[model samples]
Target: MNQNKRFCLALDLKDDPALIKKYKEYHWSGQAWPEITDSIKSAGISDMQIYCTGNRLFMIMEVDETFDPKKKAEMDVNNPKVQEWERLMDQFQIPLPWAEDGQKWVPMDKIFQLA
Candidate 1:
């Protein structure tokens, strides 16, 4: 069995209960669009999960050696289905005030791990 590398990221949803509920609906209950999951797998992501508290979301992603953020980003740039999904998701997502311009899902640093 191969052990995949893990990465964490975070983003925030608009501070509205209704929109946040819809956001959770799309993500929870296995309702995510097929194209979105396909794109993620094609990008070398072996597994992904998202957790939310209040309006903030945390994501854990596990990927194989072939995973390259730059490459995945370039691929997403040209994928119409991914683009459409992103546009729809944008309605419920809000950039963290400290996020870089137009950036979503900012990478998080691991502070400590008990080994």
Candidate 2:
């Protein structure tokens, strides 16, 4: 199997069950907005997956060797579609308390890995 860098990040959903259901719906492949996926690929993300437990969400992204989070973030800032998608998603997402202001999907520390 090929090896790639993986980034793990976490965020929380609004506590309302209805909102949580809506959030999950948006993540369904059939329901996902294509522009968002396109932007991710253009940002050098080879694969992306999201998981949820209760209101907490965990995102795993497999990125190309050249992927740079800062660069991707800068690109996202200039992409109207990406901004729109983020605004729509903001309805259901909440930053973790430990996250700095304006931060979303805070990066998680890697505690262990199997070799």
Candidate 3:
């Protein structure tokens, strides 16, 4: 990644225990995670990491300036494999009340970072 690149995203989770359990099962079972991971890579992101604590899921990705969030979002929507993966995941997702319509995962704005 270029030194100037920046990437980060945050996804608020559903407090429902059932939803959390279901998400864990799908991710650890390897039924759909590999494809989803690969799709992100195919889109030109790097050094991605996912973290969950309590009801928040945070993802830090390394992406160059050329990366366009809208384009990436469209790629995810256009890919059948990605679409299916998302469909499987919809059951576990809960939209945040503060988010705009149809937004599930909300991006975090960077406030400060150390080099």
Candidate 4:
């Protein structure tokens, strides 16, 4: 598993039911998951899955060791479609109670790995 170089990211959704409904609608409207999965695959990611439970979204992405996070960030920032997607989705996202301002999605740190 270590050799595979997969990373997991977890994020929480707003507790409000209306916000959750908006979030799901926005996500589904853009057909985002499939497109994002395709983009990651084309960028050399081997496997990916996103799951939601109790207002939490967890993403597991299997990426090549050479994958460049900086490049990915740049692409995301510069893409108009991505920008629009974020803008639409941002309406429903609420920062965690302890999150810093302007931070809605927080990345979980990796603490353990399986053999």
* Window of ten residues with lowest summed lDDT in model 2: 29-38
Task: Give lDDT per model, in order.
Answer: 0.95, 0.93, 0.75, 0.69
> Model 4 has how many clashing residue pairs?
0
True-vs-predicted CA distance for residue 17, candidate 4, Å: 2.3
Order by TM-score, highest first: 1, 2, 3, 4
Q: Which is the leading candidate under lDDT? A: 1
In candidate 3, how many Å is residue 86 off?
A: 0.8
Q: Candidate 2: which stretches are off by over 4 Å? A: 1-3
Roughly what TM-score does model 1 have, to 2 decimal places? 0.95
Please provide, for model 4 over 1-115, each residue's C-alpha lDDT reduced to its tens digit, 9 standing for 90 to 100.
Answer: 5656767766677788888866766555445665555566666678766677778877787888667766776777777766776777776666666667766556668877697
List candidate 4 stretches off by more than 4 Å.
1-3, 25-30, 33-35, 97-104, 110-115
lDDT of 1 by residue, 7-37 (tens): 9999999999999999999998569999899
Clashing pairs in 3: none
What is candidate 2's lDDT per residue for 1-115, written digit by digit as tens? 6667999999999999999999999999767788888889988899999999999999999998778999999999999999999999999999999999999999999999899
Rank candidates by lDDT, best first: 1, 2, 3, 4
- The TM-scores of all predictions, comma-separated, are 0.95, 0.94, 0.79, 0.69
lDDT of 4 at 40: 64
Kindly indicate the candidate among 1 and 2 with the higher TM-score: 1
Q: How accurate is candidate 4 locally (lDDT)?
A: 0.69
